[model samples]
Target: MKILLIEDEKDLAKSIQDYLKTNDFVCEWVTDFSLALEKIALYDYDCILLDLMLPRGNGFDILSHLKKLNKSDGVIIISAKQNLETRLEGFNLGADDYLVKPFHLSELLVRIQALIRRKKFDGNNIITFNEIQIDLLSKVVKVHGISIDVTKKEIDLLLFLIGNNKKVLSKEAIAEHLSGDMADMIDNHDFVYAHIKNIKKKLKNAESKSYIKTVYGLGYKWEDE
Candidate 1:
């Protein structure tokens, strides 16, 4: 999943980014509220980790703006203030969850996963598409009752495609989802093709139905029917 972390503490932000990366999540950081506002308007993210106090503007304003725009992106308030009023205000503004500062990274990750499940997958840990099954928590894929050993990126790619079945996903989106904002600095997206090919080969070997279809001169889509 893709996450936008709006935190001003550079060291903490870096640590959080690294932790999420290790756990198969693409995270982008935005210390400046203006830039963050622009990004939230332009692109869609699965979740937003917002800090109440920011450099340019407060996170609550951004949250209000997001709601005004009818953006359904999940929000998690990560602030130092742990009072009831702050927490209530966050919830009133439509925050999916709230986490206080100086918390464990692992705990934050768990909360994020829970929020995503509640928002996107109806709180299910396993995602099912036809005969194929994916365990979101374990990051495992099974076809026809047999386990398929695959790379992390392969699982991420498959999950992304499955979630957006029948929608054409461009190479750029795939790159960004898999590699975060740093993907933009890359020269070419040729490596995306390699990952797709590898995922297809694995699924084929498992005797599962081929679901990924490449759109000519565009991108790829996943559809079971």
Candidate 2:
């Protein structure tokens, strides 16, 4: 999933970014509230980690801006404020979860996972489509009791398609979802086609019906009907 972490603390931001990257998540971080606002305006993030206190602007302002945009971006507030008022205010502004500083990174991760689960999958760890079952928490894919051996990107691709089933996903959109802003710098999105091909090959090999279709001159869609 794509995560935008807006924390002004340099050390903490770097640590969190490094840790999340190691855990198979694409994370973009900004230390300034202005930068955070720009990112939120320009991109669609699966989740946002927001710290209430920022140098130029407060995180609450960012929250209000997000609401104005009608963005369903899952937000987790991480701040030093442990008071009830702050927590309540964050929740009032539509924060999915709140975590205080000086907490374990593990705990923060757990909360973030829970928030993502709630926002994206309705708190389900397993995602199902037809005969295919994906254990999101474990990162496993199964087809008719047979486990599939797939790479991380393969699983990401499958989940993205399944989540947006029946919707056409542009090559640029797919690349952005998988590779974040770096997608724009690439010379080609042919890699997306390669991933699609691999996914189709694996599913077809397992006697599964192909659900992905190409929209010539446009993009691809995950349509089963």
TM-score of each model, in listed order: 0.92, 0.95
The superposed Cα distance between candidate 2 and the true structure at residue 112, in angstroms, equals 1.9
Residues 28-145, candidate 2: write the lDDT tens digits: 9999988998899888888899999998999889999999999998999999999999999999988889999977888877887788778777788998888789998799999876
Model 2 TM-score is 0.95
Steric clash pairs (candidate 1): none
lDDT (0 to 1) per candidate: 0.89, 0.88
Which residues of candidate 2, in runs, are more than 4 Å off? none
Q: What is the lDDT of residue 70 in candidate 2?
A: 98
Q: What is the per-residue lDDT of model 1 for residues 61-87, given as tens digits with 9 covering 90 to 100?
A: 998999999999899999999999999
Off by over 4 Å in 1: none
TM-score quality measure for candidate 1:
0.92
lDDT of 1: 0.89
